[model samples]
Target: MHETVTVAHDDAAVVKMADLFDPEPATWGLRGDPYVWAALRKHLSGKDIPASLNEVLALLHAAFDELVGLDLVTEPASSVYREQYAHGGMSGGMIDLDAWRQRLIPLLTERARMRLEA
Candidate 1:
């Protein structure tokens, strides 16, 4: 069976997304994943969500750049992870984790931000 989850479009919901970084064990899974943790910290700041989609996209872009700048997701590391996955190891489903951080996430987050804006 497939389960459906829905989030209401409101500041409270946006704030909940931002609160994923709250350092509790329940939310700490992403904390050990360097790329995701850093990107989240860079993008979601303060207690309130911004008022515009452009601002949200800008934050996401900034977060992506910050993750790259930090070297948390390095090409060499990504290559290693890719090789492991190819050899049947579970490298979190991505052939390249860095590529996911640098490319896909910003694209997806921007799309979500646009939907939230609407």
Candidate 2:
């Protein structure tokens, strides 16, 4: 049994939200994923967190879609090629969309919730 927590959308709250990725995730979907995450954090740092969790989710998803050039929710289990983020020898600039939706998004959401409780 869990109660819904209302997320704060103030400057401090949003700063904390964006800082969730400060240390970066332990694992990534592909070589360029870290670059995408870096870009994603920079992108999010400027915006205000929405009041509702759903809106927060939408905000994150939309940012990811914009930076990755594909919507993870509708896209199939495939990788998107990004020349701008290419650095590795193989699979450079290729990002795993499934990992973003399944791993990153949920991780951010959970971090948000934890922040609320703290």
Candidate 3:
């Protein structure tokens, strides 16, 4: 059986999408993943929801590239080095690009499209 879902088109929906950043998603690939989440949250804060999925995706990709300092969507790298997040010794400031593209981004997009009202 397939569940029906509605995509909310309001500021509250935008807020919900932005909230997806906090509480630190469990599916992070590296130590610096939380840093990226924070950055994404900041990027999406007070932002309007795009009219089209493609537009929203483009906005998300731009934010991701800006935070990670590389165009993961276009370049598709294994990882990217970040000096700001380098404080963590284990990850060595590297954010797993594939994880963001394959996992986190999709999760965020899914949430972005979810209905706020029952």
Candidate 4:
């Protein structure tokens, strides 16, 4: 459900969606998870989503491409790096964003963020 769009940048969504490749409908907690979805639906109870699925899809694609192109952004399973990566498949809890951010925030730089945002 997650209708509010907690994060503005689509890269995060794109990363989540990338897990849905090659015909697998990837599960992203609240997004694809029944329990999480129910919670989010309740969280946004009675409110309308300002954006449509296609809009979300486009944003994710853009963010994903931007991240992939090294427009200065980095992915969780960093396409650029291997040293900092956690060794596991997409289904593991390792890719869970809170975990990713906990690990990534220290490694990523303000300079990188500025560069990427620019």
Q: Give model 2's clash tally.
A: 0
Query: Can you list the residue pairs that collide in candidate 2?
Result: none
User: Which candidate leads in lDDT?
Assistant: 2
Per-residue CA lDDT of candidate 2, range 1-118, in tens?
9999998767543444576675678999999888898888888886655556787788888988888778888988667888988997698998877788788888887776666556
What is the model-wide C-alpha lDDT for candidate 2? 0.79
Clashes of each: 0, 0, 0, 0
TM-score of each: 0.36, 0.81, 0.76, 0.21
> What CA RMSD would you report for each candidate?
13.4, 8.9, 9.7, 16.6
Put down candidate 4 lDDT per residue, 1-118, tens digits, no spaces. 6677565666433222222221222343212122222332333333322234444334433442433232223454422322222234443222233322343222222222332344
Q: Which candidate's TM-score is highest?
A: 2
Say which prediction, candidate 2 or candidate 3, comes out ahead on lDDT.
2
TM for candidate 1 is 0.36
Q: Please provide, for model 3 over 1-118, each residue's C-alpha lDDT reduced to its tens digit, 9 standing for 90 to 100.
A: 9999998767543454476555557667877777888878887887766655676678889988777777875775688778887765778678888888888887777665652321
> By the TM-score metric, which is better: model 1 or model 3?
3
Error of 3 at 30 (Å): 1.0
